[model samples]
Target: MIATPQSCQELLAHMVGFDTVVAYHSGVAEAERKLSDYLAGLATAWGFTVRELPIEGACGNLLIEHCIDPTLPWLMFDSHMDTVGVEGMTIDPFGGEIRDGRLYGRGACDTKGTGAAMLWALREYAAGSQKPRNIAVLFSVGEEHVQTGARAFVEQHLALLDWTPAGVVAGEPTQMQVLGATGGFVRWKMTTLGQACHSSKPDRGHNAIYDMARLVTALEDDYIGKIRATHPLVGNASAAITVINGGKQVNVVPAEATITFDRRLVPGEDGQRELNAVQALAAQVAASRPGMQVTHHQFESAPPMGTVDGGQFANQAVTALEGVGISSEVAGEPFTTNGNHFAAAGIPTIVVGPGDIAQAHTPDEWVSLEELDRGIAGYAAIMKS
Candidate 1:
């Protein structure tokens, strides 16, 4: 068995040494296997039952359970194992180098920092005489891309688990603040069709690119501009045309053009409703231009997280941080997380961790050692509370 990690820094160092960068489209990788094996060994050494739920070929989510009593309410902690690609990283991506009181690596700030803190807290709790609350820790896979691991856990493992959780805390770069609300999003593509003809005789054929441009302008003015709904914490619902592609050679008139949209939703906004609205807008634009046709295809939709502010779970988290002499406030995040899945399943969820979201996917990502140390105590205190 691998030696037990004595501190958060040591655990983070060991974790960052593995290049768990998940490749797009292709999911299989050796780094995730090594890291999962190391984590499983540590959990087993600490008297926790470990189970690996396969998400794909060799990638899976690890569930570490320490159940003292089935009657007690269980609390779940979650963090992701996969990191984004390190193609343009400035420093060695897997070096785990510490400099100027910060640890630098790909997943260091995004989640490994939080994961180390969670493990350290669990270790400390298992070694102490105090009978902390029953807990389950999930190290999920594919969080950086599609969140297949989290979905699998909720759909497959949640029903199979023996205990029902009272609450869940998802690990993210929240700067140690409790996030009770977060935005959701939907991504889709729109295609505009036209007729192809000789460029010299432009009057004979319609240009798809020009039709797409008109559609974009109409969407910006009529659809996006008309949205007046807003949320207190997560701000307003918004939409953006993120990607556009079209055309062939300069001599040929393009027959088709496409654009992708990223639409952010607040708590009350329904993703399907929003998609229908966009489709209607596209139909309206197509109708305005004779002989033009537009089609929309949706790719993904994640619901916004809405937990009661200052409720039991949030208050408990705040009290835990305060017990450790760390001051924090409940806030909202503009981005979606794995917490959304749990919250959507009717479990009260909070997102809290040690780093800033700004540094999550940067070139030289880093997390403060001081914050990580505080996170260890904070998480332990939450369990104890």
Candidate 2:
């Protein structure tokens, strides 16, 4: 059997070697399977019981448990296995090369760095004589795209567990700081339909592109501008039209046009309510313009995370960072993480890890060794607490 990783850096290198970008579009499935196998081996060697919870075909979530007593409150450390697609990357996506105290790879900074740290902390806890609490490490898949892995774990595995966790620390790039809250998101597509005709006879057909332009303007001026309330940490709720597609040809009047919108929700904001408001606006716009049909399809609505447990876990996390000599303040993230799903499951969740968010999903993604070492220490401290 392959030996367990001796250190956090070694484990991170092994994790970066896997090209576990999501399947279908990327068509690569071996990376997640291989990484799961590696983690299972290490968990088995460390005297932990490992369970592979099946997600979509061939993709699964790995849960490693080190339980000293059933009565003790369990603490869960979560991180995703999949990384964003490595298209247009400057460095080798799976190279796992270390240079100038930085590790270069796709998942190095975004998540695998924290995954390694979590695993290392678990290993250390298992080897140590004093067991502070029961621990469970979850390495989930499909975090970058749909979050199928995390959702499945919550609905399937977490419900089946005998004990509820005291808290959950989701692994994300936060420069070794604790994230107390984060903005959630709602995304959808709005489409306008009209009749197609020749450019020379443009007056004969209603232009879908023109109809969509009016709809966009209405949303920006009416719906988005009306959001006055703001979360203390994550700032005001915001909306933007991210993608738009229209004309089929230069000479033909387009018969259909579509635009995609992304709306960020602050804590205490209802994502479904916000989406319903948009749909209402779309219907109003369509009714105002004769022959112009506007329709929207809701794709996703992820709830915003809040410090619902009265900040006990946040305080413990802050103390953990301070013990490691890492200067960190409780903060909020503009983007969501797997923690959103966990928080939805009634688990007090926080996002903390190494590296910077700016480097994630970049052309030459990298994480500094200094921050990685600090992350390992911080996670160990948190687990012990």
Candidate 3:
């Protein structure tokens, strides 16, 4: 059965019904497990073999496989099962309501729509008389938060495949365009310590907030532009102090201050080296201030996806999209995705799918019904190409 816009929308509604938000971020356990099981069931019913890659303390990933020609190179499609929190949603986060030719839900655009399209494409191809290259669909978890599912897939399960992948298409909200490259991320915490005193006191104690103010000022004025590393596709690296906390009460002078530093790394830039540079600057700031202490702790780091290695696969994807009557082009984005992990693992990969990225994580998230139909056809074309 060929997939249609109405069928895609129905499947998307069912997918959106599952509250697959990452447990790490939402404090909800097995957030993706039910959806993984449900999707696995669908794949099994469609005659595709399914394997579960368990992610410790989380739902895990689903690998749905279908092979036709063993001698032919395999193609992989990856889409995350998890969505961000629905804290400020204006519509029903799980309703999957269709209004004005669009489907509304938390993951409607950012990517359950892609997931449904992939599933339908696989089903259609498997049921049809002709089979293209061997296919695998990986539904990964934790993409909205730490991306542990993708990392685990690359580190552990990727070697399990019998055939080398010709290319990997990572499903992101790319509006059917091919995202050839994307920026990376490194986040760490910086802390400043000082003596505590009453707010009314006249220079009785050092203010940690004041010290942190100087460090932030230095970062904004001196350090931000210093990230000279530039990638031809994703552009230059950048950094910002995203979160800060200092005082506990209005009348008390704070003794400690902490700020979270988030740095975006372009391809060819080292994440640890970026963190080290920030720490060095913090050390300099601390040395300049008398009786002040500054410390740092690194937390998250994700490598960037580069276009140079994935250019061929991206072009293939562009051709596939163009075949489906969509105007597609290879592009770059400042945001990171699971494609980074896949590309880092030496699999030529591109990020592409239906819907506008601007709709992702918005209060009224949506994906157009027409785009959903195109996504099914586009993914099916790539599967056969």
Candidate 4:
């Protein structure tokens, strides 16, 4: 289990072979559970203590530890096990093909590469000359969707340890940069209700689509421009209409129309307050019309990764990357990560990992083998810190 470049690639290939997409219908996805089993088996064989946490509404998590001394604090690393769906991929999504010095697969770049690198790094650290700190690796699930895995871990499983971790590095596609901040998000759906009738007698029916059009226009014209509150690291908040559905048949006027939007939250802003503002705007739109009826359903509100109590650790992480010949600085990401959960729990959390974020969830996702090797070295150096 020495984490060489070749070994990391081989491990990533095995990881990519499992289709661990979050199954919303069945709660924790079966493939994700299987993948966790596989990693737990490997950790057990390598002399690490493994604990399985079967989450209720998400794919479960694995907490694998190597305790050199029980009295010492721990350094934990987290990387999710689930990936987004692979519907429009151009290449074999699970093939793990190698070409032009890159490894191509669904989760190769987004996160599986980081998990593999971390495992290999831990392998080396356990056998290294200086084992100053106990190490823990959290392979969390449901990161691509609701982030329930990380949330559950912070809320429930963190007490399993004798003391809180000294620092936590949540693995993500950061191009080897240390991330200090990341945006959070809130998603909601709105449905407009109206009377339905045959298209031949359209005058007798009230058009829900027409009402929905007005609401969408109001969101674009009035609401989108107002959420301009900015943070120095993560930048401005954004609102986008991502999904719309209406009409049951061509011959009938639609009775209901639904639209979903995502609102990105910056560091200082509050998710609940912003969601309330959107609801207020939609209520205004409905009030202006004679018979418009609208309903709002808030899906989820997740907080952003703001400055942690242990902010000084970012400097140590940067220095660690520098030691491995990878020039890195403290930066921010527009997208969110599992680090948000740790940061909310008052742990010194930073996001860093192997690949580029641009390749994540793309049709032809990939990770450069050379960068992955460097990632292994960088993680090893961080462990030493």
Q: Per-residue CA lDDT of candidate 4, range 1-385, in tens?
A: 5322348789898889888876763344455887788898888888999988777745578988999899888999999988888888999989989899999999999889999999989999998988889999999988887787889988987776566888899999898999989999988899999999999998899999999999999999999976678888788889899999999999999999999989999898888888888899999999999789999885886799987764588888999899879999988877889998899898889999999999999999999999889888998999987
Every candidate's lDDT: 0.85, 0.87, 0.87, 0.88
lDDT of 3 by residue, 328-364 (tens): 8888888999999988888899998989999999999
Worst ten in a row by lDDT for model 3: 1-10
Candidate 1: lDDT over CA atoms?
0.85
Ranking by TM-score: 2, 1, 3, 4
Off by over 4 Å in 3: 1-6, 200-204, 308-310
Give Cα distance to truth, residue 168, candidate 1, Å. Answer: 0.5
Off by over 4 Å in 1: 1-3, 25-31, 56-58, 308-310
Write the residue-wise lDDT of candidate 1 on 246-315 in tens digits: 9888977889999999989888888889988889889988998888999877588888988844467887
Every model: Cα RMSD to truth: 1.8, 1.5, 2.6, 2.5
List TM-score per model, in order.
0.95, 0.96, 0.94, 0.93
- Give the lDDT of residue 236 in candidate 4: 83
- RMSD in Å for candidate 2, one decimal? 1.5
Candidate 4 lDDT: 0.88
